[model samples]
Structures are given as C-alpha cells and as structure tokens.
Target: MSSEVDKGSSTQRKEGESKRSKPILTRSVSQLAVAEAQHLVLWKKPLSTIYHLVQYMADNFVYLYSEIVRNKIFVFCGIIILIGSYFLDNIEGPHQALFDAVKKNGYWMSYWTFLGFLSSFGFGTGLHTFLLYLGPHIAHVTLAAWTCKSLDFPEPPYPDTIICPTQESAESVVSFWTIFNKVSVEAICWGAGTAIGELPPYFMARTARRSGENLEEEEQSSAKKKVQELVTRFGFFGILLCASIPNPLFDLAGITCGYFLIPFSTFFSATLVGKAGIKMAMQTSFIIIVFTESYLKMVIRLIAGIPKFGAILEPYITDYFEQQRIKLKLGQDSNDGGLVSFLLTCLVTGMIMYFVISTINSLAQQHLIQELKKQSKSESKKDK
Candidate 1:
C-alpha cells in the first residue's frame, strides 16, 4: 500500500544528470546534485523513524554492520543483555492479582484504577532517566513515534515483548547506547535489587499521540526539559532513590504536595524515586499475571458470575489518555481528532496494549450494565 516517490517527478533533474555530472559519488558535486535532486523531486516519505533508521542502515550496511559493532561492542553487548532482561519480567502472583482485581472489582473498576497507576509511572521514570543518564533519552522513543508517524511504518520490535529503546541502534545515539548498557550491567550485577531496584517494574511511559489527543499539548518541549534538569541536579544518586520507592505512595505524597507547588518541580522531585519503582512494578506485575495459578482463580471468579466493580475504569483509562494528550500536547483529543475512530484503527492494527481499556468499555461500560439486567431478571423469576 505504501510507495516510494520517484525523484524524476519532483526534480527537474534526473538521477542520470547527477550521475553524469559526478560519477564519483563521494565528491561535493554529487552532494550538491543530490540536494538539488531532493528539492526538485516529489517523493513519498518512509513509514516511521525506526523505518527511516533501518533504511539508512540498509543503505550503508557495508560501512556500519561491522566497524560500528566493533567500536561499540561493549555497549552493544550490554544492550544485548538489556534485551535479555525481558525474560525476567513475569509476576505470576501479581498477574493473578491483576486478574483478581479485574474479576472481583469488575473489569471497569480495575480500569479506572490504572490512572493512578500510569501517572505514577511518569513520576519515577522521569527521575530515573534524568538522574542517572543526564540525557533526555526518553525522546529516543517519542522521536521514533514521530518518525513512524511521518513515514507510516509499524513498530519493528523483536518477538520478545520487553521494550528496547528504538534508537539503541541508531547511528547517532552511540553514547546513549553506552550509558543505557552501563545501567543494564549494574542491574545484572546487583540483582533486581529490592523490588524498587528492579528494571522490569516499569513499562516505557505510554505515549498519548496514539490516542489523538492534542498534538500541540503533547508536543510540549518542557516535559523533556524538566526530566533532563532533574538528572542534572540529582544524578544517579537521585536515581537510586527513584529505583527504590513504591509508586503509589510516592505519587500520593507528590500530587498532594504538588497542588500548591509547580507541576515541574513536583513532578521532577516525585520522579527522583518514581521511575525505577514504577517500571519495576509494571514489569513485576506483568510477569506475575502471565504465569501464576492465582491468575486462574482470578479468571474463574469472573466466569462464575462474581459481581466485579469496574464502574469507573473505562472513563478513567480514557481520561488517562486524555490527560497525557493534554500534558504532552499531541494532535487532538478523542473528541477533536476523531480519536475514538482512530482508537478503533489502533484496535484493528493489533496494538494489544489497549485491549484492557477496550475490555473495560465493552464489559463494564456496556456489557456489564446489560449483564446486571439479566441477573436481576433471573432473581425476580426465582423469587416468584
């Protein structure tokens, strides 16, 4: 369905004209010729940032594949180890807890509950990345998202669901890769380190651009700036604290303290201890949910007609997306950007991360309301 634009259409110049002028592709003449060519050419863009990167690497494979790997082998190996860390992410007990939360509380209630869960994540990761890395490296992913949006490419992740930063292999981010690998090495050497020290606890902070929230709001330059500054001040010692605190209490204390204070300072300080703990929780929960027997029990309770309390979950999740949409200042909200329609598109595109929200809507918002009617009717009949 996607096509590359042919240079001939936009450029009055032909590739032939350029090749003829300078057969030595390395010469300045070739460079000028190429620039003239792109200026004149009407070409379709690539699908995404990652797509653009992979394409760039593909275009220069002979130069990059070996020497770059050699120069950066230590970092590469550490990144390799980080990728391996995904295997440790399951939490059978927590996974069961999630299921139990869903079943006993109702899918909807559990859904509403995740807002506190997600926002709390932002607090910590912002701190961890800023303090330890001193780079607004989080953009590594957002930039990828922007790149993907520009090109329309799907995410090119490996089969393992553990997220590796999209730009780990980017030609420009060599230092970032090195730093990230350093952290991964530390995690490995120390162990998941008291639940807070665990790397998997947090999922990469979710982006709201996907939900069609305000593009302007989502595009705010300050979010990255705040996180980066926090890093500058605290360094990783600040990070160690972030990697240790529980997210809920951390956020609870933060938001309460923050209402009278500025959002950035509140968020930045909260982040100091928030990022690592938040990520660890998610990673731990994800692992537990997928593997444990308690998971089975949680599922069983739902099937057996237990009244789950998910009344506010759908709206909560939706609001969470909206909140990020506003905070990050993306394109438009669900109301303006045809977000509901676009969300449907995501559903079709196989972004399963949103399924929980979807289930909440279908079951708790619509289905459960009807299910309750059925239960009421059966009860009345038995009473008669």
Candidate 2:
C-alpha cells in the first residue's frame, strides 16, 4: 500500500511539472511570434501608408477635380502660367534679355532682387533664403573685408552695397550696424513672405470652423498641444514671442489663432514684427559676428583635430571655405544650378503640390457633405 501511494504522488508531481513546462514553451513561442510581427510591421508601415494615401487620392480624384473646376479663376491662371512658361523657355533672344534685365535690376537691397529668394523661402519647407542666398552674401562681404584689408564695398548686382557706412579708417571692420543696414530690406521681405505663408493654415482652419467641422477631437502631439495652449493664453504678444525666436511650432500658433477666430490684422502684424524685425536682426547679427571674427574657422580647426572623422570633415570644410573665397573673388551669384539648387527646386515643387492637394481635398469634403445633405432632404420629402 505504501509503495502504491508513493508511486501515485510521484506520478502527480511529474504531471504538474510537465503542465508548467508546456506553458513556458508556449509563452516563448508566442513572444517570438509577436516580435516577428512587430519587425514586419516596422518594414510594412511606410509602404502601407503610401498605398493608403494613393488609394485615398484615387477615391477622391473625381470630387477633387470637380471642386478645382468650380474655381474657374485658379484653373485659368494656372493654364495661362503654364502656356506662358513654355513659350518663354523656347524664345532665346527675348529670354536672355529678360534674364539680363532681372540680373541688373535685382541687386541686394532692391526689393525686386530678393523677391525670388523671398518667395522660395516663404513657400517651401527646408528652403530658407538665409542659408542659400542672404547668409552667403553676408559671409562673402565679411570675408572680402577681412582678406582685402580695405572697406571697399562692391557695386550692386555684384556684392550688395550697405545703406549706412560708419567706418573711420580704410581698414574694414564689419560692425553690427553695418551688417544690419545691408541685409535689412531683404530680411523684411523674407519675413513678410513667411507671414504670408502662414495665411493658408489660418484660412483653412477658419473655414473648417465656419463649416461646423470640429478639429478639436483630432489627436495632437504633446509639443503641438503646448504651443496651441501658449498661443491661446497670450494672444498677440504670444504670437510675436513665438515668431521672434525661430520656433518651428509657429504653424501651430497660426492654426490655433485661426480656429479661435483671431483677427487677421492682429495675427499678421504680430508675426511681421516678430519675424522681420526681431528674428532677422538676431540672425543677421550672429552671422556677421561669426564670419567677421575667427570663431567659425577656429571651430572648424578644432573639429578637424578630432581623431578619425576629423580627417574626413577637414577636406570638406576647407573646400567650402575655398569655394566661398573664389565666389567672392569672382563676384558671381551662388545660384549655379548645382545639386543644392536642384534640391531646392524639388522641395519647392513638392511643397506647392502638397498645398494644392490639401486645399482640393478640403474643398471636396465640404462639397460632398453638402450633396449628401441635399440628397437626404429630398428622400425624406418623398417618404413623407
């Protein structure tokens, strides 16, 4: 009897152990399956997003086209511009003359000269004029003074001439005031253009609000929520402060202000002051100090002294400085249709396309809703 009881206990113990071990094995397999699924999802997410985007566009293409056609003025203008551009591209003599005329009249300080740069900067993401056009111009001016050891300002259409000169000696000292005067007009124009760019978001938000569309329920990032809160709390001064400091969240501010039904004049005025007045001045001053002094060069030298990456960075840095020097010496503009220019053109095209598509989608949604409402009302009347 004792032996049988012992055998039974041993058998039960073995069964329990097997049961426990089976769960562990199952759990391990499930964990691996989950991990593999996640990995696949990571790879598939972008492709799925693109596929869905294309599908959505395809579904709404008819509505979008109808909405676009309803706006006859926009369609007419677009067609005219396209036809004009094609013809202008083919005509050589007149085109060359027009180009020469633009080159001559569009000097730095001429509002006309900076128009293209201003518009480009305003209309697109990652295509600021400061980095491409104005920043380089300021650097070249500072370097020219430093290398030439004289205060000889270049003629217009070459290097930009400053408005106010305040040097006592022939030796060039690029003062804060001097740099400020040189790039002020261009900066203001660029600032105004940026302010104008903010209008689309504002208008879209306002239109949605007026159309009884609620965007409040939309999921927002923590950062965007915080920016919207700040804009709402502070109003005009809040917008000015946000705009003045080179904040990327200014778009959120514009959207919030528009959704809350803020006046256009107040929002625009504050933005203009912040971006054109304070922000531009700050940027201009920083560039002047960096290029005029040995700070940037010293930093480059320090980086080049690093172990492995230093050697790689040194050549590129040296080449960049050399190119800048050559450009200044040759008195040529930096829009040489290089890789950077090509990239800028691509970015601008993408931004324009995005804006047009978004606008059309919004209009189409509104039109579709109206049509649905009318159809429902007619059906109810027929039923009655």
Candidate 3:
C-alpha cells in the first residue's frame, strides 16, 4: 500500500512539472489578444455619438427639458457657474483665472456658440454638426440660441445658414443647389480631416520599423497581418461604413489604411463617398421636412390623423408648425430669451450627448470582446 501511494504521488509531481514547463511562446499570443482587447475597450467609442445623441434629444425633447428644470441641484450648480463666470469675465485677476482656465482646458466661453461652424472638420465636440442638422430644421431659433447676444453679431445672420429658400422666391434654385454644395463640402472636409488623423499612427508604425526602435520583426509582422486581414475582410465596404457611421473606430481603419500604404486615391475616394452619402441623406431630409411646405403640411396632417395618439398630440403638432412658421419669418421671441432657457437647452443637450456616447461605448466594447476571441483562436491555431 505504501509503494502504491508513493508511485501515485510521484506521478502527480511529474505531471505538475510538465505543465509548468509549457512554452511561454504559446501563451504570448493569447496575452497579446487580451491586451489589445482591453486597449480597444478602454477607448475607441463613437465620439460623434455625443453630437447625434444631443440632436436626438433635441428632436424628442419634452420630459428631458422638464426633468432638467426640476432638478434643484442642477439649477443651483448652474446658477453658481453662471454667476462665477460672469464675475470672472469682468474681473480678470489671476493668470489662471476661471474663464481663462476653462478656455485653456477646451471649454468654450464667450462667443463659444460660433465654434459649431468650425466643427465641419471634426474639430470641436460636434456641436457644429448638430447645428448643421438643426439649422434648416429650426432655422433662426437654433442659431440664435447658440450665438451670444453680446457679440452684437449683426442684423443679418451668417451667409451659409441652412435656411431653405422660400417657395415664392426665385432664389429657390440657388438654395436647392446650396443643399448639394453644402453636403459635398462637408463630406470632403470631414473625410480629409479623418484621413489626416490617421497619419500619426501610420507614421509611428513606419518609423518604428525603419528605426528598429526595439520593435521586433514578429510584432511588426503581426500588425501588418492584422491590417491585411482588415483589408481582405471588409475592403471598400468596410472603409465606407466606418466613414459614413458616426463611429470612433474609423480612426483605426484609417490607421490601417495608412500603415498598409493603401493608394491615397482609394482611401480618399471611399471616405468621400461614404461621408457624402451621410451628409446628403441628412441635408435632403432637412430640405424635405423644413423647406418644402407641401411635404410639411402632409406630414402634419398624417400626424394629426393618427388614431389614438393624434388627439393627444394635436396641440403639440400645431404649436410646432406655428413655431416653424414664426422661425421662417425670423421673428425672435421671448421664449428664445433668458438665461434659464439657455441653461435648459444646454442641460438637455449634455444629457442626450452622454446617453448616445455611452450606448456607443458599450457597443464598441462588445465588438472588441468578439475581436479578442477571434484573435485568441487564431493565436491558438498557430501555436498548435
């Protein structure tokens, strides 16, 4: 019995030793996969989602506005911030003063509303794109609300404002042309910006290989393989989808395109096509809904004719049309005035932006998880 127990114990020890002696090379791939997965999860969410979400909230803004108004804490904090900013703007005491500090940290201050116009290149926090969407829809209200009255801007608004031409006006043809022009310009600008954003990562990879900066051939080979895989898997459709969609992952695709030295023509063309599609869709929608009176009337009628909800929604529907009419006439009102209303708008915008961003982040995480699993399997096969 003692001999049998000793033999069994010895066998177990040998088995354990063999397991411990397994090759580290076999594990590295899985480790790398996990690390890449974690990195992707940590970042690469749709930043543009914040803009779209804000627009969506603005589109379906009811409870959201009231909720913001009802929040005493929010109201108090807002008041404090406003009062403090006002004082800071006037005082200008310290070098790192409150308003200056906020500006330094990328928070928009006085005349900050015009920052939207510059956002066509994905430069700012996407407020401008939202403005681009809202401009034609809400006309002057969206513009006036965002612009600072202190600017004493002018009697006439910016020339590029998205207001559709009146039907009775001969300039309607020009306005129609402007719609296509606007979409094309936005697509090219944004697409170029996105492509430019990819250059840093691509150059870094190239520089590393050229300089042999502690980067192993195997690692470089792996990265190249990954890029090649992407190119093979998605090709033009993949590039187009990423560009068209408000996704943060587009940067990765861009980087991959650069790293592989994809023809500049191909990359630019795909991006332009995708972005143009998106902008055209948005612009056309705005034109149809806001500019075309017949279409607007038909839509309102349809909404009013709905069975159960129509009656309940009738007042809101009518009010919206009336508001649009006033907006078209450029009649600014008290409703668009006051710090309170501005604060409410800001609160609603922020809430919607956050919600959209968070949802996209979750989706990005799910995608990353799947990618990790795929990479792990590939790694495992190579090991075998």
Index of the highest-lDDT prediction: 2
Provide backbone clash counts, one per model.
Answer: 56, 0, 1
**Whole-model Cα lDDT per candidate?**
0.35, 0.63, 0.49
**In terms of TM-score, how similar is model 2 to the real structure?**
0.56
lDDT of 3 by residue, 20-86 (tens): 6543443554456446544442245345434434444454477567877789798889999989877
Q: Write the per-residue lDDT of candidate 2 for residues 1-384, one digit (tens) a residue.
A: 999999999999999999988556544543443343333221355454344445546656976888888997999999998898667756787577775666454553355234423433321342455665667666666666555444455444334432222233555455656656755666676666666667766776788689764453334689888888888889889889988888677777887888898899888899888877888788777877887647778777898999998988777766666655566555545765444446657876776565454444434434343344446447657987
Q: Candidate 2 — what's its lDDT?
A: 0.63
For candidate 1, write residues 183-214 as lDDT tens digits. 33222212222222221122111121223211
Per-residue lDDT, model 2, residue 69, is: 84
| Cα error of candidate 3 at position 218, Å | 18
Q: How big is the RMSD of model 3?
A: 16.3
Candidate 3 residue spans exceeding 4 A from truth: 1-155, 159-175, 178-230, 233-249, 263-266, 276-291, 301-314, 337-348, 351-384
Top candidate on TM-score is 2
